[model samples]
Target chain A: MKKRDIILVAAVLILAGGIWLITRVFFNDSGGQLRITVDNEIYGTYDLKQDQEIQIGTTNTCEIKGGKVTMIQADCPDHICMHSAAIDKDGGTIVCMPNRVFLEIVGQEDGGVDTIAQ
Target chain B: MKNKIAFLGLFAALAIILGYVESLLPVFIGIPGIKLGLTNLVIVFILYLYSWKEALLISVVRILAIGFLFGNLYSILFSLAGGVLSLFVMYFMRKIPGFSVLGVSVAGGVTHNIGQLFVAAFVVTNFKLMYYLPVLLVSGVVTGLLIGMVSGEIWKHVGAYIRKNNREKL
Candidate 1:
């Protein structure tokens, strides 16, 4: 094996491991989602009902109906979120990576206002 | 050249299909642009089958076709960066005379992801996005290994056939 082989393997392993670890930290449910940012905006006590619509980030749009929020449209290049269906239940999350928006349903953890940005 | 082009076209089709199929597969991990990269097998196959230029062409065709068909416009740049980086690594590995294409593939995949990450870090106005690089790299390793192993087996079959056919012609 060339020294390049060793270097490449080590580099990939270390970086991938770190990203995986951070993903776990961000996505893993603990107590509840402390913050929810849709397009980097901090909305307070986001109340939702059936058929309520909201735009996520700049590209994607979302709606809530029957106490569930679903992505309606995404101008994002991938439209992965637009392809992703709605979330009507608790503990559901939506991510638009290109738009850099993350939407989450924070359950009755503290049951009050909280800072929703990292 | 026509026969060679025909063979290349076939491989390109295979790579495109693999790329699309992989998109539908559930994320082994949740990070975007991070996946098993099942199609790199085609790249590895090309690396073994012909010259570096041929392999590089396959990589370009496959990445562009899949990106245009299934992904957004920005994907083009990222794919280009990754493909170029991968071929560079593969070219070096090929210099070792009898270097295993599988090993070359592993290097390619990892370096491709690295290239993508580097571009993301530099291109994006917000530097915080670099945070995602760690995960993309990790996924690259596993996927690279998978493509490597499969391509290694495939190379055996393709190599034997090519040798046999060439000898008959000679």
Candidate 2:
């Protein structure tokens, strides 16, 4: 309602500043890939855009393709992992919560976990 | 007592209508289940025009009915926690001199989001969800402003109605 109130609103917006620095330091998601392998193969690689697909067959055999790893055809019912896009940055994860699987990419810059693959 | 019950029923219906209308305005952001909380206007007005008990009752009924009607049972935990926390915050804030219904409403809006975010972190099993906190807070500020404005307007109208009715009675 007042000129000062306008300044206060602007100050709040500018100062909010994401509070993201705390997250970066606390999580320690700095440089380097969190390499992942399943069933004796390079099943998933993080922190890059390789976009590979990995297929697991019969719960015993795992195949890698497309530069990333995927459950391909998992025995799980949700198939939520299949819906995830490819991740290539820090905080990115390929999580199969039902199948007891987790793959994370920790890029130093990106805070978003984009893809949870099959 | 009968009059109070009738007034509460009317507030319940008003809350339901506002909740339904607010649901139609979606955030373009991909996050799910976040809302602007337009129904808060009724609760804010109740705190000043009625009593804390009545305001709290309205909050609970509003959230429960909205949750059930939308089949958002999975999100009920967040809604319940947020609704209670927001009401508590506003109830305490109402004690301040000149705080007015608008100030109480703003405080409630902010606290609601705070409570919901706390639940979200636990559900996802990852604290990374905290990154969205700032966004949520900013949204809270905007929605708070809107709710505050609406509550202020409603209070003015209600005050005018009471004055007019009193004059007629005399």
Candidate 3:
């Protein structure tokens, strides 16, 4: 490979690694609640500690078990949300773009309200 | 002139076919934007063979065709964002010295994902979508390298053949 090509590849790797480090250090935390949103509006917040299934607007079904939330079922054609990895303590997201459903792990210290800036 | 136009059409068709092939594959790592970016092979090749104008045209045509045939309106918007941004990046990268098709293609692939992420964030009205940056960047680089390698191989033989044909015609 050319010198510039190697540099280009190395640059991308380093940038990706840096972003990952930042996210792990700053964003990811042992969250207590899973925030579900539809079309940017709050749908509901479920506790990760409790095991339960939630149906969001008849388009998606989410399950919370063992401190992890997963899109157990979806009617979307791609089923991308269904295939996405479960979001847990380390703070991740599952977005079903087709259905406009978004599930995220947020550290809600105050169970009364979502004060987290997100 | 006719030959060049015909080749551009062929390239667009090939890109669409690659897009279809990619659709057949299951989503990788469960990430929305992560894919083989197989169609980029044609885009990179055409960029080197012709100019950004032709490359842009082919890219647009392929995205529109594939988007309508297999995807929905939302998908079309996302694809347009990614495709146009990547094409611009590749066009500029090609002008830099010592950076070959591999480098240009890598730039294209990574920027493509970034562009899509921006649109996704805007659509969802949440910047938290940036959370996927790390994974998307890594996937882009990996797929870009693979596509670039194949493109380089194709350019070696096809580029030479095309140049020879042009000289004979002249």
Best by TM-score: 3
Residue B147 local lDDT, model 1:
82
lDDT of 1 by residue, B100-152 (tens): 66568777877888787677656654445555666566666777777877878
Q: Is candidate 1 or candidate 3 better by DockQ?
A: 3
Candidate ranking (DockQ, best to worst):
3, 1, 2
Judged by lDDT relative to the true structure, which candidate is superior, 2 or 3? 3
Residues A6-115, candidate 2, lDDT per residue (tens digit)? 44445445544546556556654444464554544565544433344434334422223433434455566786765566544434566565665555554435344433
DockQ of each: 0.20, 0.13, 0.33
Q: Candidate 3 lDDT, tens digit per residue, B1-170?
A: 87888889899999999999999888766655688899999999888888899989999999999989988776788889999999999999999889988898889999999998898778767676677898889899988988989999999999878878885442
> What is the lDDT ranking, best to worst?
3, 1, 2
TM-score per model over all chains: 0.59, 0.66, 0.71
Candidate 3 residue pairs in clash (backbone atoms < 3 Å)? none
Each candidate's fnat, in order? 0.47, 0.11, 0.78
- lDDT (10s digit) by residue, model 3, range A1-118: 7999999999999999999999888866535689999999999988787889999999999999988899999999999999998888667899999999999878743322121211
Show where candidate 3 strays beyond 4 Å: A30-118, B168-170
lDDT of 1 by residue, A53-105 (tens): 77644566777666666667877788776667665434567787887767777
Model 2 chain B is weakest, by summed lDDT over 10 consecutive residues, at: B161-170
Instruction: Please give, as one word, the docking class of candidate 2.
Output: incorrect
Decreasing TM-score order of the candidates:
3, 2, 1
In candidate 1, position B35 carries an lDDT of 64
lDDT of model number 2: 0.65
TM-score of chain A considered alone, across all candidate predictions: 0.51, 0.39, 0.65
